[model samples]
Target: MSSPSDSTACDLYDADRPLNMRCACGRNHGRGAEIEVSPDDKLEASLMKALFPVDSVRRGFLRAVGANTARAAIASVLPLGTLQAMAQDKAPLEKTNLKIGFIPITCATPLIMAHPLGFYQKQGLNVEVVKTAGWALIRDKMLNKEYDATHFLSPMPLAISMGAGSNQVAMNVATIQNTNGQAITLANKHKDKRDPKMWKGMKFAVPFEYSMHNFLLRYYVAEAGLNPDTDIQIRVVPPPEMVANLRAGNIDGYLGPDPFNQRAVFEEIGFLHLLTRDLWNGHPCCAFGTSAEFIEKNPNTFAALVRSVLTASAMARDPKNRELVAKVIAPAQYLNQPETVISQVLTGKFADGLGNIRTVPDRADFDPIPWQSMAVWMLTQMKRWGYVKGDVNYRQIAEKVFLLTDAKKRMKELGQAAPEGAYPKFTIMGKVFDPAKPDDYVKSFAISKMA
Candidate 1:
């Protein structure tokens, strides 16, 4: 039995190749040329080339010092072995144990389910999906770095990055959590006042000032020919408290995340007045993101986290897994909502609180692609509503914050078809929004708060 070190030079070289082709160690080595060298292998080869400018010098030095001695010397001098190892598989992840924050909403389905479904564990990560009190708390904890990553309103990352609502700390939206899963749920008493014209002086609740729920509610009412600012009042209420507020008569209705919207119906307090999907079929509702600093420091860990969430997103996207997902995430450790209510939201077939069963399968969807156009749309809305002012570089900010490149790579890695084009046109309330002309889209809104 030949020892590893006693192997012939040709055999040693052949070991590195995919196929064992015995060839002289020369410039034109035989069939071994066809073998692909991995990144780590390339690193090692490059280092060897740099260390000895002449091939004869390298061979003589290796022959003199021996392979084991040469490896020890290289490792001691420059950490060549470590560098090669890192180049091979992403440096063993900068982090393994992580604390992620989330609100108990269906928008966080992928993130929440990742914990119970062992997706994080599969990625060699121990993730704690801490159920936060509300969106504001989630934002605060994320900003403080109390939680490594958190569920964000799709607009929140953009807002945070631009310093619109909080201190400008660069954030990145890794993937959209859910889309078209929100609804304008009104109190049962307001059933007679379905028209926005009759909603004058009505108090409404939104999860956050910088949330898609707020933007969608504003747009919906504005399209109904009512000024969202003065004609109706919009308060920032947590989703968990939406049903309670509605039942207490403190709020007339809320455009909130589920299963709160569906929970209201189950509790006999509110009716689903309108699904946000009716206004925009594929509107982004929430996002999974972390600070840009975190990603820079822990690229591998962040990639693993993205893979885990995207895997969960892929699972959540299938209609067949909706019931199972609802069951998996409806426990006290997760969403903490009734399984039936959560099932109704995830399954997309539920009582509208008006005694009729409504079926809209895409009512709550888990599309993880973080399209840049979606960010552009959010920016346009932000400009239209005066959340942002002055000349806005729509595409620049969209690309910076949305992480479209990262999303595309991860989606492709998971065998999902990545969406083409960063700026795809979308229609909101029948108005075409071309991302190329975001300023025009903002100007086209008649009932805007833009100065």
Candidate 2:
């Protein structure tokens, strides 16, 4: 459905206008002026025919609005590229029924809620969002392919991929499940010792060694002139047991995921000292991903899984939906926490264990972008703390493990705002981290274990 500039050009054949030209300078165009007929053009033509099979009606419609205007109107209603992609992406999933592991924490809000909300089913994927015991088990299961996909600490994938704490298995973080949802909680007995300088020789628990909890805690105390390695005891305590450990005096405090932070406050055993977001706003805590092998072998299924989680992430981002999400994911099958504690964590209105209800709405967020720069920062920390030795290819490892570009592309396709590329700078504890100068950034730290 088009009109040519030259009066000599006759319309294409159907019922109204008969074809007059064959393959030549005039073919599918005016005698002199021409417009390229693209595949999009063919698609539009077919859609036009379907809409108005009677050629006279189609001709009248085009005459009234003109081809350019008509195209603009239709495209505004339904983008042609999106429509074509939807039509073409109906491939059978290589693996439909899948088990996706998750630690029962609010950091996994999107992945956990996707199951109850049927977002996975919408993509024709039957997903079981299994409540996992801890982060190490999540890693082991992923390594064994016992779980098709799982919730991961944002740094876990990078660590696992580099063989930092486990055997090397190539992993890819598809999307950050949640951000700014972790906190440093302290035993109520030590509430007077809010200063990190006073925390010397104190025992602390982190969900995993390869976690933002560990990195951020190290960074926090390190900035306070306390070497996290020698001055503090950082234990790998499972999140579910963090509150119990705090209650039993097994650990003095923890930099851990919620609703455990809120759980400790609710149980009167601990108080929230500072949210990790205070250390670095919009910092990624947990990620949703599968191995690179899984993604390659089950591209369609992986895409479906990503689409489902992203849909849930969008839903969870709205503050209005936080309470609903808390309710949805608070059942015994998911986070297994009290609704009030989960609500406090998700809605950001909670007792700080010192007689104050803090209302910081961005306290937790579902920012799905797995920024590669975050990976770069994690790598720098690994090197700084002697977790990884020798020369490290920060950018190469970051780009391979954190699928930021793919996340952005998928976000764009999902009609979400895909922020510009991967390596945006981050401000942590008043220090600017330039991803391009990761080595310098690490060396700049005063209390690192770097040789």
Candidate 3:
């Protein structure tokens, strides 16, 4: 059984706070105490109330604190036995023989490997792998119900949950798919080894306009002392078209995931500038998300689906499962690469342009605080950039996007351990961020354009 005083990092509050004080540490609070509620803060608080009404009780406890904060905190207190029971005792999902959608990329390894290796089956799921053109298309499919769920960029689901991207029904990320596989590739033309200043007039492409790939690129250019919007024109292009765009000199550089990053180097189209892993340690790059309706209608399937991801991720992380993943992702339509290529990328090895080869850093080995913090950070960006129209509370939406309680329950079932914080914490670009201090953390970043 769990107690309110327990110190699990997933525990939203400690014994130190006023009982009525909320744990807004990550998703709900804005950094620390806002001594005075500005118009913006008032608007943020109002939006929170709309999503999680102030009067709502959580876990049978009338909220003594902020509603959403209490809602999230109470959800995190589920006992391990109860979690296992939820997985075992719930009626099997309405749709067990599931056809899941994914873009053909290495990041979808968990779903691909899970399906063939019988991991989903072990969790009582019958999963069929469906491929999509890109993240945008995948989003549409997930929204249209063409897919039960799909491996998605973590921010996409959050974007939806907050009503940032589409007014369609909200979706939620049940678990992280894979992290740290994305990279920013620069065209060789912009790769002037002799003159670093030559990049003063270049266009860099990002897969989506308001995406982490774009955010990371902006941060990188800012760190290099260049204006992201003015110093270098940032172009928006699809991931598959990034290399071709580079080859055609349509854009100078772009950020994308593995294989595409590798293929660019292999074909001499661009120079790999930096992997996201180098920028944000263990950033939650992608996840498995489904609509709220799907979840409410089929809780049993949701638990099973989460269990499958856990098992598959464990296998992919384990050296013994390397051959298994290679075999699973071998279909030409999928990762569609040779066994050696799949092996190299999946286990963190990469092909150098030279005859020599080496293992690049593994970015997936990250704590969970980064995930929680980034959720809050993305919301800030959305508001700052006008991606979200009208009055919307950033903090309230962060709660729905994060779904920390569900993630914790799933993690507990997987037996995979996370860091000792209620949320994942890490430094990005040398700035230390604790989700507990979301507003301060957002302020710490050099870019303050998030409205």
Candidate 4:
């Protein structure tokens, strides 16, 4: 076979013809056509058609300089060889059949929906999204490598990477699965005590210690001049059991993921005390991610996986698709909850359990962009709450753990505009969280567990 440098340059930049269309040379070509041809084939066809627009002149030129020289000339101009290699480059998947784990909550919508919607199959992947019991089990399975990827609490990856709750394993957050979808639910008895100051001495539940729920809950209570570690009793309870705990009065309230928060309101055991969105609007709740080793071992598979989830996230972001997404992921195979409960969480329209119907369309959103600032903030909280002990390299860990680059690329691939920047300033409860000065931010907190 003639080397790429030896091939002649073909004038294949046709403005009118579709990229995938067959050229006059009886070969398929196009600029953006959805043709089945490999990238190399497409490039070759386009080049041949362009170089020899008039078959007689092209034949004469090729006969003179030869095909190899022509290729070298073309390579010198457009780097067609490199482009063709990229187009045709299909990285063989290290593993195709994969098991991904996710909790049965609205926060895991993108990952769960990807399966039913055939997004995984579209990328030549066979993904089994196992409905995990809770966040702790999900973490365990991930560390054990029983699950290749998982629905993670946005902070879990950071904590896991640092060996906080599990052995130190480098993990990466592929995307923020859902944001601002969590709520602090209180037993109906505490409805009269609507203030956080009144929450002192009350027992509250969070899905995991290394969860956004925990951090946000602590921040919310601390901002009220109450110590999260001493003033309030915070317990690690699985989300599905939160409502039950509320019903049994096992816990006074919980800052947890949906549809459990909504489920509590549905069960009439608790009222929506406050949405986490109220504490920090647009806060990231959960993430879609896997271990760093997995990404390193299967780069293409991971890329395809990120693209599939990003596609699902793009669909889930649309309000028009929320109701449909609710139905699709509500079955026993996925969330295993009432469709109405899931719908309320996904659509952002639900009863506040006080007879008021609240409508906040962005109450829960699948933004998919894993902002590094989010990770930075989580680190600050981890430091604030004594999760990570000494001087923490906040930005380095944030960049290492959150796959912002991959998330942005996949978002763009799915026609979504990726948000710019590594660390964006966030206003949590009216206080600016400058990720640049996390230690200062931690020091600013009055009721932290920090000594």
Candidate 5:
């Protein structure tokens, strides 16, 4: 037997596990009845007691105003739904405050947009997306623990982990930030010399030594029968300065990230010679990652970060939503470019700076998967260029750094259609790259720095 005063009857009333002889409390002439007290009913009771404070007054007020009227009054003033959510979600975060670094490029679309849209807050994180000056600064900050995570040029983690261009620090790429969002832009002065073979004796710029921009530029020039080292000059320049440098005639052209590539076109200084997607249709350009040490210390925080970014990635993948996304990220605090320019870069329709409008929708895509094979391909380039010397255990390094399994798990949890397998073959410039035989692929390159 249970009375209305009993918490078991008032709060823990489960219909399947009903208490025998439950008091109806004046209902049906005081007969025992099967009753179910909901969470709302319990909340209403608590709120009523708080409002009245005296039992006699609470009973009198409820009797006069009625339960339905009381619930409406409580909900209007108190936002009971928010209270319920706060009560239900009590998972303590390992870290709530974090700083993420990024360059002012459209490649950082997902991570950058997550800030303004409250995705980080939704996961109980207070993330500050810091705008970095250059790739070297981004690497230095990450190494010194100044940034918890960063926007990495996709090959950066592989290079940094292998001690190629910097002191070795283990980094893990959580997601490929953007793919196919880069272009080979030449100054308008060299519009007649569009062919790569003619690009010999010309100075070129890349964002970093370990960037896909560098490798792709090297591959493109090599295919045209020119040694990238001897026949031409390649310099490392920050993405934001790429257009300004071109305008000042500091360099002939650059294979750089957008909205800078588009910025070059927008400013009328350079023309889009070719999109990198023309060289390798889906080549990865930028990535979002943190140190492996950070992941080990704050696994939950890292998972939340990935979720926040991936959610933005899923939203940005829709072509119709791109213009809206551009508006959100183009303000001073984020990418700091004109909305129209960012929209042009994101929406994939723009002027080529050569008197024509071009539309290539996958020109920029938010594919979050960091395939291990992508890591292996990057490694082969690193070896071929002598950035890494001798036999590389390609598989071991690829699996350790890329984190394909974790990405797929998080994507599936968010109901995004994630693919199976860690390795997928890609054809770059009509040559099929087999990730399984990385050594053979490295040797096959005709003008490799490899002995």
Candidate 6:
């Protein structure tokens, strides 16, 4: 094989493979050798164009978000020593040593992993992970800046952005935090009637009536020819209480996040009918969202935050990071399951009550770009359900709420990869599916209305 240092025009030098393809530039390498230049190398291009073909710009609007390279270019004009000192003395924003709220779940693993793994400290940020009771609290605290940010539901940002439950605030979501951890579970009584067509009437519990979970359930019920408003009843219940309610027969079914889904299985209280991710492949599920003001006032700080989450997300997606994530997410304060149990959940493996462990099939994972699509879809559903006022344009609501451009800019600065090769894309149930037109996408949904 040709050596990378042979000057073939690629900017990487190969090293031994058994220990991973380390870069000759002295940076520890993992699978990054597959890319021409590692983003950690401080290369000139934004992380998006580097990993994806530069031609992808024609395909997606994310590429339209310009790079803030003027700062770096301006720094290059300064004396070398001055640049070095500037880098060394870069004090963190007054926002350092802050608390960020999050609910306990496997999806919150990235935030938990970042702290002990040194991602936050590396970015010159000191973040305390505070556990909250519900999304409403997470939203309230984040809005007031009482908590810097949170491991929030993907819809939370859009909902807050549109002022769905409160005031309109410009929030920024740059990186998709985690995906595909949600499930729609049915009580044991309904397990035999797995096919929705066989059931005439059923009651479902969603964390909130207007959340993405609610819309997803409505969509699935609609697919089954059940009218959400008349055929099925959707009640609101916290995720942690879902398993108990299912066991006690208070609710017919529940849509919830894991390890609660895992807990139901372990306790033999409910059977998972389908994972929420199965509703739409590769959908935008959850992300790191902050205020619009935060992005403008502290671009560098915001970029660093994006980079930290990006790094954590990459690690979470890697198979080698299983034990690390399991240990972080399965504490008594978090999931309350054993690390081994959490490990199985992370790897998509499960143990039934009879001590039979099985490998679960690969499910569709979350992608960043789908976040905007999900927001738009939610807007349509809100209007359809009469949750929000009439005459609300979903497209306009999506643009105002989801800050794809701001996130793209930050991703480029930190060298994190971005969506390319199509501005209008949709992810349904963890699959990177696409629609020809936005108007057609909304019209295709029978349970939602046009913007």
Model 2: clashing residue pairs? none
Query: Which digits, one per residue and each the tens of the lDDT, describe model 2 over residues 51-122?
Result: 354556766877787756765654443234443454355678999999999999998998987776556755
- TM-score of each candidate structure, all chains considered together: 0.80, 0.81, 0.73, 0.80, 0.81, 0.73
Q: What does the lDDT read for residue 186 in candidate 2?
A: 95
lDDT of 5 by residue, 119-164 (tens): 6766678999999989999999999999999999999999899888
CA shift of 389, model 3, Å: 5.9
User: lDDT scores for all predictions?
Assistant: 0.81, 0.82, 0.62, 0.80, 0.82, 0.61
User: Residue 398 of candidate 5: its Cα lDDT?
Assistant: 96
Whole-model alpha-carbon lDDT for candidate 5? 0.82
Which stretches of model 4 miss by more than 4 angstroms? 1-90
Query: Using lDDT as the measure, what is the rank order of every candidate, best first?
Result: 5, 2, 1, 4, 3, 6
- Identify the superior model by TM-score, candidate 1 or candidate 2: 2
What value does the lDDT take at residue 345 in candidate 3?
63
Worst 10 residues of 1 by lDDT: 15-24
True-structure lDDT of candidate 6: 0.61
* CA lDDT, candidate 3, residue 396: 65
Backbone atom clashes (below 3 Å) for every candidate: 0, 0, 10, 15, 0, 13
Q: Put down candidate 6 lDDT per residue, 91-174, tens digits, no spaces.
A: 466456767777776767777666655566656777787878777778889888898767777777776776778788877566
Worst-scoring 10-residue span by lDDT in model 2: 12-21
Native-to-model Cα distance after best TM-score fit, residue 312 in candidate 4, in Å: 0.2
RMSD of each: 16.1, 14.1, 19.6, 13.5, 13.3, 12.9
Q: What does the lDDT come to for candidate 2?
A: 0.82
